[model samples]
Target: MKTILKNHRRKVTVYLGRRDFVDNSSTTEPIDGVVSITYRFGREEDEVMGINFSKEMQLVCREIPLKRDVKVTEMQERLLTKLGASAYPFSIDIPDNAPCSVQLFSDHSVKQ
Candidate 1:
């Protein structure tokens, strides 16, 4: 697993392999300019009378601006050329109090 420090900034490069893969004409809003990250936690309970007994919570919702004109690595450049993908670069500043990712198994064990 990789560890990222809190309050530190990390650079990420996003590569879209196909431009025509998404149908933008069907949507009223443009799908560019921002990157959003959301954390969801949910638990399933007994379903009674055809009602869903699942409980869910939105722990985090964050958005950062998608930037461009950044430099790419040599391997990324080669892959971009080979796959004909476009790259978008951005940096994320992890908040100091951001919660770490966690998963709970059916056995009641937790993993981080």
Candidate 2:
């Protein structure tokens, strides 16, 4: 298990973009967007083969901007990549107890 101090900062990139579903035209421009890190998981309670116990569950969720307020000029947007997106760098330190993303078929019935 890797250990991280409380003061350690985790770095991440924030991508900004826009999509128009009406015309099937989509554009993405990396602008300043709010980034947040969260820990998501639940306990698995089950009884199997006369055994009753709970297991640790950890899940990874995709990063989505919770809030956005950046505005870019037309020229800046045009200068963006063909996807019309720019990437902003950010960092956040997570708790040491945070579970790392690991794929384990603890429950054989579910394939993640």
Candidate 3:
């Protein structure tokens, strides 16, 4: 499924679903699904005059639905049923002053 965020400073709902996976192991486990929003500034591997600058930031990171069970809405239920899968619904709210998506390149010599 595809989800588009029209407003960068608004809350967005997300749905995560998974089908069972079979492995040739005696142990069986169900993996928990999670969603995360992270921001990285500067280059961690790049250095200028032996000085490196990098920042690790996280806005939101948590398991889907926050609970251990799946609680879907009516619309979500219909959608999941049509897709032939079970899903967990969750929401992520972006701060009011959150930065909008941007892409920057240090290689000015490269053509766009």
> lDDT of each prediction vs. the true structure?
0.34, 0.32, 0.40
For all candidates, the clash counts are 0, 10, 0
lDDT, model 1: 0.34
Better of 1 and 3 by lDDT: 3
> For model 2, how does the per-residue alpha-carbon lDDT over 19-80 read when each residue is reduced to its tens digit?
21122124222222223232334542322333322344543244544323445445324333
lDDT of 1 by residue, 1-112 (tens): 1112111122333342222222234332212222223233453232232332233345435453244455554544454454333333233333334334433343233334
Error of 3 at 62 (Å): 1.8
For candidate 1, the per-residue lDDT at 99 reads: 38
Better of 1 and 2 by TM-score: 1
In model 2, what lDDT does residue 38 have? Answer: 28
What value does the lDDT take at residue 44 in candidate 2?
Answer: 28
Put down candidate 3 lDDT per residue, 14-101, tens digits, no spaces. 3334434233344333322323233346564433334322433564565454442565555555555554433344544444443444
lDDT of 2 at 80: 33
Shift of residue 11 alpha carbon in model 1, Å:
22
RMSD of each: 16.8, 16.6, 17.1
**TM-scores for the candidates:** 0.26, 0.20, 0.31
TM-score of 1: 0.26
